[model samples]
Target: MRPAFVAALALCLAALPAQAQQRFKSSAGDLVVETVAEGLQNPWGLAFLPDGRMLVTERAGRLRLVSSDGKLSAAIANTPNVTGRGQGGLLDVALDPDFAGNRLIYLSFAEPRAGGNGTSVARGKLNQADTALEQVAVIFRQMPTINSNMHFGSRLVFDRTGALFVTTGDRYGQRDEAQNPANHIGKVIRIRPDGSVPADNPNKPGWQPEIWSIGHRNVQGAALHPQSGQLWTAEHGARGGDEINTPKAGLNYGWPVITYGVDYSGLKIGEGTAKAGMEQPLFYWDPSIAPSGAAFYTGERWPGWKNSLFVGGLAGQMLVRLSTQGEAVTGEERLLDGLGERIRDVRQGPDGYLYLLSDDAKGRVLRVRPAP
Candidate 1:
């Protein structure tokens, strides 16, 4: 074929969107990228309702439902108050395992408290009308809230046993706090749906009972492994060193003490890349991609991607697919860089489709389907 012909073909393929010309090529196979919804302001999180509609959170502190047909609902009434500062606002949302019966849902947000602001998790019931959250109460609060507006590392995940796992940041300015499990900053906390600590938790003397693991930086993305039932997280590093970690209870995942990246100022960070007792990451990315949301694909829509882990990127503005073999990341592939949007979250729909939320002033919810 002539070069001009090949160039024209590429341009035509690049025009794919929600309707005509929706097919795009990927290593796995051909994929049809469809715009399920658009015009969301910095959509930060997404959760599917039992009936098939989606609950989406805008970073500016509003919660809306996006119908499958592409209609976006008005902001749901009575969402908990949030602090919409730098990286702070309404964040991740998750439905209760028994949501069909209890109508309970969990939300993680940057909470404005007396000291300043910090990440907090709350639970509320979606009323029958679907217009409001009723019986809302904060289930967990980051202790001794700092004055900084950054690093409210948060993502809500529910394990197989009804336990709620909350991930937190080091509150930016206080990186040292990540090493100390006594405080909530930079920790993965495990708690009951009602905000009570589990009796079987690490509960180390002098340490907070809710802490499941420690020494994490700004871990914005997390998901439970479909087959292993283990919790995996994607975390942000300074200049480099984005990491994927499968957190185990009471383990310390060296942050400042043993980072693969350096400080933003080009200065060395931590003691080094290794330590005696700290846990090493399963994988790390140099020139950090600023990862945010994570999901494990167990669906059949993309057979080539089955059992793979998908993570969304903010700084890198793409979707990353990591081939996995039982908790091990074997290889990595970056997708959607041409979309030119910051992927804030990734999800797998019940019907075996992959969904994404693009973060921007005019964000979009996109669906990826098998193309003919």
Candidate 2:
């Protein structure tokens, strides 16, 4: 090697530690996963800060800031009171589209009410120094509280024009509301950054125009296609019908009318799999993986997984990677089963590697990278 070239290589090697390459790794054809960070508490959602820190939400109504060096900050103060029972509590976290310039973050939680509880979305500015939230405000609240504590599907995604999309659940056993136009439950809703209904939304006159799509049962994972910018969601159906649906404006997603799964009590669910006036799922799971926290792999680290969708599986306790061919969902790969934990959230980190949040009292934040 040339002297100058050798000198430059030495400088670069000295800058990065030897363990940096091992910080994340994938082995055994991406089937085996190693731990990155542990001791989390039922981690539900994670958002990346502009400075490369991670903002993680716990199911017990706590928000924690995790550093790149694996240090977790104290629980964030001033989180909204949540009804942490069954499948409810503090949920998804999303950064503002202008987060690089604004330092703003949003959180979704199950807000307790008199008769029942409702899903709520709030936005606040994050103070990295103190690891706290400031100027927090409740932006949107779901309509008509329900008695059940299950099925609060709260995920946030922003459109190209900066409009926010929020998903809600049917509140367990409320099959009829999932298809109801009057109720916001079991629907994908769109709103402005400040939580006002967009004027261009469908049914702007008498209807609750925030609703973008309806008839969804309990959608937990949603992501925008990196190429086409279209929205997609993975929802939990009954026994066998976990579905990945392409959401369309003003369309019903046939929760109670058509499903591949039966009821939890071994009863029939809806009419059948194909029904008129209802949209069909792009793909579905027979035994049900309970998908959550989806993302398109546009990162450079995963060259083979470019444009593919990665979903966390709670019921299957694995990471699912789906190959996409221009709106067609095909080819599934399950990873990290031997890790023995339910993956609740998956996102590609700003460093171009994948990050996963295990859902349990002894949860963990793990990183995945190409194996050495």
Candidate 3:
């Protein structure tokens, strides 16, 4: 071959890997992962609209619409401002249960304050024809903004009764705040669709009325159990001891006071992982998988995966599946090990397939289906 011909052949071969589909075998069946959309910047959240389109959030405070066939629209207009510093940025997106009539949507983001930034929840009406949000309002803001940008735990989930559940972090330097219900930091709050405190919330004395549960470190993932309707969450640990807990009203989850993890410097954490009056994790991982977004697999695409809980792993770069028997996690499986991309968020699409958003500057939204 001539030199020019040989060079062209080499370039073509090098580009093949980038466009190839990723395949994996799991308990469900032979799986094929295809890139549905690309060019997203650190995509953080995924929500499907009633019309089968997808609403995605990028960590740098942009929202984009993805068509059913994988085409990505330009960033939607009038998104809330976000800090985008450290672990803070645009976080989660959730649609109203009655979105067909209301066209309402909710977003979680790191709002910039005077001294620092804190997690805030906002909702607006999505105007599809114009591709902009209308009447956007900040409904809830975490209290006591701190200087550090790590651990802005934010995930939005609506319970069976249509109330909203918002998870929060301990704000990095303030682990002790997890045990304090007086503030929104390190707590899971339950509120009405219009951001009002529910009258039935466990209103302990001196605690914020919005607080539903306390003592969380950095709860990055939350889902409503498909069968039992309980709220399950996944939180980060220091060196080891990532946890999955079923948070209940007025319960403490024992973050700084009792942890299975140690300090980043290898020193032991408080109380050695067990303490009285604090709830134990339903499941936990040692050495830390850095779990993020989560969802319950009630879809029919994978016959064997019904009722399974799926969690995205950032540091592990895999999808974590937990087999649950009622309230207990019976088994665990890690998928997409070979692709080696950080899974930022996972959701079950209306078509009954699993959708994943990769966390990267040049991120892609992937769809998982059984191979034909």
Candidate 4:
């Protein structure tokens, strides 16, 4: 309240790093964004343990834990071998539904194979000492590996029925294969936790038994609707037409065949925008947000944001909030407007806060909470 005290406080605050000093406002309300930790190399995905610590993955094939006090642990050892080049690397991480008891975690990574590499999902039990993964096993692999380094659409989501859904990309050079369900180039794959094909999957003749849906370009974000229990996904578009789709059973999404986006060369793409057999998007962004990670906020810490979906904007370098009712997205707002950082993943922490991973050579773990 005094002038001298105010000057001293300003000097003290200015001495702190930007991570602790930055704040922003959103439609929900004003927010305080603080750095939980730093020194992450292109961090891609994050999952929280029940004990309030975090499991975060770096793109260079290491998994690390961030304590509640913002201390980052040494990289957990014994992770599977990843290609770790281009868009290929350790991507997304998720805990098993019963992780408290099973201690099992799943990882999606760019896997090296005979021909080249593809997205692969593996499950392993975390040791009690927090040092390494034990008994790791590959559960699913995108069919037909390719040499290209882009479009490894690798997000892991577990549905209400406990089936794990893995998103596979068109492998850059294979965009046309998205329409073909016989091989798993660009598709949402459904499999049991143990890698078995579900009997309920559409087992049509000539279709892969694990195929849940077909015709996707490069889906990097996927999450379950808190109320409807449906899987929602956000994918990258070439130049425009980034989409938010709720992929359904055995449906076609019409990626390369029909899209609102044009090719990188500014030429028309696909067979116009619609076709008879393909399903439409719930929402889409033109001029492209290049959405990467997604989550539906069900927390009470922030007003006007309950049940709203939060998506990370990679190319846009911000966060997008979508107001929702049940499964339909009704409105959209952009947050962290001038914060020039590539948001790679978004998650709702157990403490009713939102957490984000900034994708960079020197990435950071950022926590967003209500401002006082």
Cα lDDT tens digits, model 2, 11-130, are: 432232222222212332432244555678899999876556678999999998876566778898877789999999999999899987787888899999889998999988877564
RMSD of each: 7.3, 4.7, 8.4, 6.3
Runs off by more than 4 Å, candidate 1: 1-23
Q: What is the C-alpha lDDT of each candidate?
A: 0.88, 0.82, 0.88, 0.89
lDDT of 1 by residue, 1-372 (tens): 365754554343233346422566689787777788888989999998865678999999999998656788999999989999888999999999999899999999999988799899999999999999999999999987899889998999999889999999999899988999889989999999999998888998768999999999999999988888999999999999999999998899998899999999999998999999899999999989999999999877777888788999898988899998887899999886577778999999766778899899898888887777
Off by over 4 Å in 3: 1-19, 128-130
lDDT of 4 by residue, 1-372 (tens): 465754554353223243654678887678788888899999999998876678999999999998756778999999999999998899999999999899999999999988799999999999999999999999998989798789999899999888999999999889999999899988999999999998899877778999999999999999999989999999998899899999998899998999989999999998988999898888999999999999999877875788888999999999999998877889999999878889999999766778899999999988787787
Give residue 173's error in model 2 in angstroms. 2.4
How do the predictions measure up, each by TM-score? 0.94, 0.91, 0.94, 0.94
TM-score of 4: 0.94
| Cα error, candidate 2, residue 316 (Å) | 0.5
Best candidate according to lDDT: 4
The positional error of residue 315 in candidate 1, measured at the CA in angstroms, is: 1.0
> Model 4, 175: alpha-carbon shift in Å?
0.4
Selected candidate, larger TM-score, 2 vs 3: 3
At residue 89, candidate 1 shows an lDDT of 93
What are the clash counts of all predictions, listed in order?
A: 1, 0, 0, 0
